[model samples]
Target: MELKPIKTRKIYEEIVEQIRELVVRGELKPGDKLPSERDLVERLKVSRASIREALSALEMMGLLEVRSGEGTFMRRLKPESVIAPLAWMLSIEKGTVQELLEVRKILEVQAAKLAAQRAQADDLRELEDALENMRQEIVNPELGGEKADLQFHYAITRATDNKILILIMDAISDMMQQMLKTSREKLYQGKYTPNILYSEHAQIYEAIKRKDPKQASEYILEHLSGVEEELNSHIE
Candidate 1:
């Protein structure tokens, strides 16, 4: 509820920054209603147009939800919603798919290690559910397990309990999913069978469940490296 007056020429960007800072400081949270435009203008000593522009940008960033006649409220952040804008830009970038996997190896390997150390019972349940879903997908190829694969990784990030790490995962989730879908298709067409993929995931899950951080990290790295190798083969 602390609204400072804006003195900068880029008034809207300043507004966005302040609001974002509030969020980072835990002042604003999901479902909290923002001040009215009139209220914001007066509080920030800015024009209504500046307030509107900032609000629009925040909405686009998936940070706010503007319901009809209900004012604007802080949105519950979802990986897909938060990263949609960034995903669009990354989708057009050269060699982004390869880069995405490289980033994934870095993030996910550490995430697996942390998850092995910190995962709670609820986190274990989610990981198990995702693994079960993967098994089901393998049994019935029509079901498609790509979603389960993504969910498993997301559960690992959640288990880490690091907000910044979780946010970075959200930022890349869309592109990650696209990469998974394409890579899996190419891999399946090659020597990599669906069962092989499922086995690799299962091994990682077992390592985490055993609370063996070293094993979990190793398993995940090996799995990711294999996927990268397969994808490279197709590209080459």
Candidate 2:
């Protein structure tokens, strides 16, 4: 006898779907702690591995948060909640990094310009501090560079004193780091990376130091556009 077609899914994947459905359906609100592992084990009738895998998927989607030594809680959903899915999609969709960077390029360049025009003395000091940290990281090539780089971008946005702008840019911090790593990879392939970025970053710092909005904006556009061009050249 011929066998009928079988329908199947990885057990964890199905579990993940159910949990996400509950969350989207409002059965699980933001900040709600999920049931304990043992409770889920009995409810889902799945192995520990399956349960763990489902939880991992949910965590990656920003639908849930797991605190060390504490229970998992749901995160506040909105645009921020969408970031995880966007990031995962970008990873799967071929040739989208350049587009992602372009978006950041536009947002950040505008923020940089505004920051320069609006920044007060205290803002300038913060920006200078971040810049100095970046320089030290470059010179020493320590693992601390990522934090410094993030602070550098943040300083510019903070200088703008636009709470919304600062928040939005902060949300995309992960994406920025991802894109920068990719850009650096492209540059590394051509032996054109490390020194080049350090100098360009310095130029932006200099413009900010002078509080020249026009020059800061121009330099930011030029720098980010160059990165986009260099990446698209090969991947396209």
Choose the strongest candidate by lDDT: 1
Measured on C-alpha atoms, candidate 1 has an lDDT of 0.86
Clash pairs, model 1 backbone: none
lDDT tens readout by residue for model 1, 106-202:
8999999999999999999999999899989877999877899999999999999988788788777777777778777898988788799889988
* Model 2: pairs clashing at backbone N, Cα or C within 3 Å: none
Q: Once model 1 is optimally superposed onto the true structure by TM-score, how far is the C-alpha of residue 83 displaced, in angstroms?
A: 7.3
Candidates in order: C-alpha RMSD to true structure:
6.1, 7.8
For residue 235, model 2's alpha carbon misses the true position, in angstroms, by 1.7
- Residue-level error in angstroms, candidate 1, position 149: 0.6
Off by over 4 Å in 2: 1-95, 142-146
lDDT of 2 by residue, 14-133 (tens): 676566667667778888888888877777777778788778877877677899999988888766555455445444444567667777777889888887788888877876776677
Per-model TM-score on C-alpha atoms: 0.67, 0.58
Off by over 4 Å in 1: 1-59, 62-95
Output the lDDT of residue 57, model 2.
78
